[model samples]
Target chain A: MLIQRLAIIGVGLIGGSLARALKRANAVGEVIGCGRNINNLQQAVELGVIDRYDTNPAQAVTEADMIVVAVPLGTIASVFAAIRDNLSAQAIITDVGSAKATVVADARQHLGNYLPRFVPGHPIAGTEKSGVAASFAELFEQHRVILTPLQETDPQAVATVSTMWTQTGAEVIEMSVTHHDEVLAATSHLPHILAYSLVDTLAKMAERTEIFRFAAGGFRDFTRIASSDPQMWHDICLANQQAILQILDSFKTDLTQLITAIQQNDSQYIATVFSRAKSARDKFCG
Target chain B: MLIQRLAIIGVGLIGGSLARALKRANAVGEVIGCGRNINNLQQAVELGVIDRYDTNPAQAVTEADMIVVAVPLGTIASVFAAIRDNLSAQAIITDVGSAKATVVADARQHLGNYLPRFVPGHPIAGTEKSGVAASFAELFEQHRVILTPLQETDPQAVATVSTMWTQTGAEVIEMSVTHHDEVLAATSHLPHILAYSLVDTLAKMAERTEIFRFAAGGFRDFTRIASSDPQMWHDICLANQQAILQILDSFKTDLTQLITAIQQNDSQYIATVFSRAKSARDKFCG
Candidate 1:
C-alpha cells in the first residue's frame, strides 16, 4: 500500500473523491474522514468513501501516514492547529485549496518543526456541486494537481504525495506557492468575481425579468460560474487578496479603454481588441 | 404564402437561417439572397437557403413582398438607403440587428415615407460560428424574437412580421426601440465587453500559456463569448454606446464595492453579493 492510513479532514467533494479513488486503487490500507459535519462524514462512510469517520482532527490524524486537508480556505488555519500536535512525525500533509500562498503561510505558523512535511496543493478540477454525494472516483482524470512546496519541504514527502495523486489519475506539477496563487487568481478567482458582479448588476435592474428572458446563449454561457458556492468564493477572495486585486485592476483598465473606444465610435480600436481576444481564446481554449 | 417574394440582405447565419426556415415552412414563394459578397450569396443558394442570389439590394427587392435586412449594425443605414427607392410600395421592411434605437433612427433618416413599413427586430439566437454554412432551419426554434416598431409603423406590417417569426418557431414580443436597446445593453453588450476585456488581459500576462492551461471549467464557460465575431461585436458596442456606457458605469460601481470588500476582508459583504448573484442567476438562467 502507498499509505498505511490516510486521513482526509473534510468529507466534501474533493476529499471524498480522493478517498474513493484511493480505496478503488487500493493505495491506502485504511481511509479516515474527518469533518465538522457529522452527517456528511457519516454519509461518506456509508458510501464506502472512507473506512471510518471522525469529528476530531487530532484523533483522525493520530496514526495517519498521509493527511489531506480539504476544507474551505478560512478553516485551513484551524485545521492545521488542531492536528499539529497529534500528527505522526512521518506523515506527509497536503491540502486541496484553490489558493496556495495563504495555506502555506498558515502551515508555517501551525506546523512549526513539521513544516517540511506540509505541501500546499490545488487540483484544477471541480463542478459547481459540493458535498460527499457529488464525489466520484474519476473527477480528477486528465486534470492537473499543482503542488506548492516550501523551501524546507522534503523531497520524499513531495514524491509520496505526487505518486498518490498520479494513482488517482492526476498529473502533478510543482511550483512556488506565490506563483500558484497568482496564476489561479487570474484564471479562476477573477472570473468568478466578474460573473458574480455582472449577475448582481443585471439582477438589480428594473427590467431584470425581461432582460433575463431575452438573454441569448452567449449571456447564459458567460454567467454560468455566477451560480457557484458563495461562501467558498468569499473565502477564496480573501485568501488570494493581493493577486486577485492586481488582476482586477488590469481588467478594469482594459474595460475602461473599451468603454472609451465605444464612446468615440472608434470601430477600428474596438475590432482590434475583440479580434485579439478571440484569436487568443481560440488558440488557448478552442 | 406569407410572402410572395422575400428578399434577404446579407445572407450570413441570421439571414440564411431565416430563409431556410421560411422555405421549410413554405411560407415564401421565392427567397432571394443579397449581399456584397457574391461567394457567400452563391453558397447560400447552393445550400438551398435561397431560390436565387443577387449583389444589388435594389434589384433583389424589385418585386419582393417582404425584405429582411440582416447585415451588421454598421451597415444597416447603407442597406436601407440602397433599397429605399426600388422597394415596392406594398413591401414591408425589417431588420435583425442587436441594437434597435440606432437602427430605428437610421431608418427614419433613410426610409422617409417607407418608415411606416419598417419594423426593427432582434432574434436572440446564434452559435459562435457564423456564415452560410453555420445557418440552419431550426436555429430560431423556441428562441425569442423582439420587434421594436416605430410610432408611425403600420399595425398590419407589424402583424405580418410577427406572424413570419412565429412561423419560424420563434416567440415574438414587442417593445419600444429605446427599451430594447437598454435591456440588451445590460444582458448582452456589457457581458461581451467584459469577456473580451478579461481574455485580452489574461492573454497579455507573462505566464499566459500556463494560466490558460490550468483554467478550470468555470473559466472556460465564463469566457466562451470572448471567441465571438470581433467586427460584429464592435458594431454592437458602437451601435448601443449610450446604453452600454450606462450599464458599464453601474457595473463599475458594483465591482468597486466588491474590490473594497475583498481588500477589507469583509466576508459578510462578499458573501451577500455572491449569494445574491448565485440565487439570481439560478432563478433567471438556471
Candidate 2:
C-alpha cells in the first residue's frame, strides 16, 4: 500500500473523494476522516468513504503515514496547528486548498518542524455541489492537480504526495506557490467573483423576475458559477487577496475599454475584441 | 394560415429558425428568405427552412402579408428601408433585434407610414452557433419572446405578431420599448459583454495557455457566451448603449465594493454578497 494510514481533515467533497479513490485503488490501508461537522464525518464513514472518523485532528493523524488537509482557506492554519504535534515524522502532508500560497504560509506558521513534510497542493476539480455524499472515486480522473511545494519541503514528501494523486488518475504538476496563486486568481477566483457580482447586480434590478424569466441559455451558462459555495469563496478571496485584486483590476481595465468602444460607436474595436476572445477560447476550450 | 406569404430578412439562425417553427406549426402559407449572404439563403432554401429565396428585400416582401426583419441591430434600419416601399399597406412588420428602443427608432426613421405596422421584438433564444444550418424548429420552445410595440403601432399587428410567436411555442410578453431595453441591458447584453471582456483579458495574460488548461467547469460555463458572434454582439452593444452603460455602472459599483471587501479582509461582507447572489440565482434559475 502507498500509505499505512491515511488521515483526511475536513472530510467534505475533496477529502472524501480522495479517500474513496485511494480506497478503490487499494493505495491506502486505512482511511480516517476528521472534521468539525459530526454529521458529515459520520456520513463519510457510513458511506464507506472512510474506514473511521474522528473529531480531533491531532488524534486522527497520530498514526497516519499521510495526512491530507482538505479544509477551507480560512481554517488551514488551525488545521495545520491541530495536526502538527501528533504528525508522524515520516508522514507526508498535503492539502487540497484552492489558494496554495496562503496555505503554504499557514503551514510555515503552524507546522514549525513538520514544515518539511508539508507539500501544498490544489486539485483543479469539483462541482458546485459539496459534502461527502456528492463526492465519488472518479472525481479526480483526467483532472490536473497542482503541487506548490515550499522551499523547505522534502523532495520525497512531494514525490509521495504526487504519486498518491497520480494513482487517483490525476496528472500532477509542480509549480511555485506564488505562481499557483496568480494563475488561479485569474482563472478561477476572478471568474467566480464576476459571476456573483453580475448575478447580484441583475437580481437587484426593478424588472428582475422578467429579466430572469427571459434570460437565455447564454445568461444561464455565464452566471452558473454564481451558485457556488459562499463561505468557501469568501475564504478564497481573502486568502488570495493581492493576486485576485491585480487580476480584477486588469479585467476592469478591459471592461472599461469595451465600454468606451461601445459608447463611441466603435463597432470595429468591439468586433476586434470579441473576435480575438472567440478565437482564443475556441483554440483553448475546443 | 396566419399569413398568406411571410418574408424573413436576414435568414440566419433567428430568422431561419422562426421560419422552420412556423412551417412546422402550419402557421404560414409561404416563407421567403432574404439576406446579403447568398450561400446562407440558398442553404435555407435547400434545407426547406424557407419556400423561396431572394437577395432583394424589396422583391422578397412584395405581396407578403408579414415581414420579419432579423438582421444584425446595425443593419435593421437599412433592411426596413429596403422593404418599406414594396410592403403592402395591410402588411405587418416586425423585427427580432436585441435592442428595442433603437429598433423602434430605426423603424420610425426608415419605415415612414409603415412605422405604425412595425412591432419591435426580441426572442430570447439562440445558441452560440449561427447561420441557417444552425437553425432548428424547436429553438424557441419554452422561450420568452418580448415585444416592444410602438405607441403608434396597430393593436391588430401586435396581436397577430404575438399569436405567431405563440404558435412557435414561445411565451409572448409585451413591455414598453425603454423597459425592454433596460431589462435586456441588465440580463442579456451586460452578461455577454462581461463574458467577452473576461475572456479577452485572460487570453492576453502571459500564461494564457496554462490558465485556460487549468480553468475548471465554472470558468467554462462563465465564458461560454464569449464564443458568440462578434458582429452580432458589436451591434448589440452599440444599439443598447444607454441602458447597457447604466447597468454597467451599477455592476462596476458592486464590483468595487466586493474588491474593497476583499482588500480589507472583510470576510463577512464577502460572504454576505456571495450568499445573497447564490440565494438569488438558485431561487431564480432553479
lDDT of each: 0.91, 0.90
**Per-prediction DockQ, in order?**
0.83, 0.80
**Reference-based TM-score of each model:** 0.97, 0.97
Give the poorly placed runs of model 1, Cα more than 4 Å off: none
Model 2 TM-score (2 dp): 0.97
Candidate 2 ranges beyond 4 A from true positions: none
List fnat per candidate, in order: 0.92, 0.86
Tell me the docking grade of candidate 1.
Answer: high
lDDT of 2 by residue, A104-176 (tens): 7888899999889888899999988778999899999999999988778899999999999999999999998
For candidate 1, write residues A228-256 as lDDT tens digits: 88988999999999999999999988888
Error of 2 at B29 (Å): 2.2
In order, the B-chain TM-scores come to 0.98, 0.98
Best model number under DockQ: 1
